[model samples]
Target: MLSTKVAADTTPSTRNYDDNVAVDTKKKVDRARGNITQRRCLIDNIWNAHVVDYAHVYEADGKKDGLISKLERSWNVKSGTLNSNTRRNIFRLSAKLHRLFDEEKWLLLPETKIVDQYYEHYREAGYADEFPVIKDLSFNYTLVAHPDMRQVAIHRRVEGVDINTPGAFKTFIYPFDTFPVIVSHVHPCFVICNSGQKLKDYDKIVAFRKGDTDQRKKRIARIQSFSKRLDGW
Candidate 1:
């Protein structure tokens, strides 16, 4: 009888949750997993995300004329401030993505296997994509408090070093202290990806596309042009 009772207890039955709120919460959590939002520019196809924000979502006034009002939606991704950990996550994701691409290229897997192999290799290598898979993964970090300015991911690794912990497998890496060093660099990108990170300092960033001296001159010229236009109006 005990044996029979144990067997019955061990048998599993399909059970479902009835609470709608609980279900919805779980779903929402699932959705916001990895959505780290930051404005960035592609430097050498590697993204440089400056966590500092300088953007304002613009709005238009009512009673605009037809021609001017006809202008479609306009927006801008302004630069903003950032903190250290957030910068770490952002650069880490980017570097991992690039690293995966490199590994994939080296693997030369048949096209048929690319899809299956892509993610597997990504896990084995690292997740630098920074794309949040669900709500649970959402860290909700913002600029100004995070990375504050000059953090970056560097992937240049040492020569002849074999990675066993997925260590410097790709360029963008940090303490990821969990993985073994041998596993870090993987195989193809096994150069023990070296990274040098400097925090974002306004003077250091050179974020402005125009060089320093040139930028000042350009700004003066632009103001002059705008002033003349306003005067004509």
Candidate 2:
């Protein structure tokens, strides 16, 4: 009789409130599990939506090797091989091509397996490494009031560098036209634009461009010519 009573108590129709709660909890757990699986699938698709392999393209092209060799020669020209001005022109042209690739969004973020590889390449080898994935770059400048009556304080931080430092951090400030030279020290695959001008109210950066002195002069000339033409109209 005890065995029969135990079987009757174990049946669903004879269950208590605790048993109903347990069943509802199990259903919620199953739904949460399903949601997590679906989210992972969606994230995977987004992460790999635009994977580009630049090295593979360069390898597939038959003349890539010769072209790279020529550029390197131009970059490393000795005192007698090419005049200093000519060498500078070559360097500028090469830099312009790199800046164009970055500005035009030709390079896309690589896959996870190779992303670290490209980062290491850029960090160690500078701009001459395999083409790096380009992303928007910006700087942060913070201003705070000093305890003294007459003075204010300014602090600056570049986009990629670390924030934590023990002592006074030195920052290099250059004219807007020299921005490209400043960035070339970090990497050639970057361009400075005024996208943040309206957001930050950065008046000085209104005419900044990623080019050398000559390029900056040409840009100024074009702007002046346009202004004059408009006035004549």
In model 1, the runs with Cα more than 4 Å from the true position are 1-211, 214-219, 227-232
Which digits, one per residue and each the tens of the lDDT, describe model 1 over residues 122-176?
A: 3453422331122122222101111221243434333335644555345532222
- The global C-alpha lDDT for each of the candidates, from Candidate 1 onward, is 0.22, 0.24
> Which candidate wins on lDDT?
2
In candidate 2, what are the lDDT values of residues 48-157, reduced to their tens digit? 11221111101101222333343234234222232111100111112222232223212111122233433354347543324444332211111111122122111223
Hey, what RMSD does candidate 2 come out at? 26.4
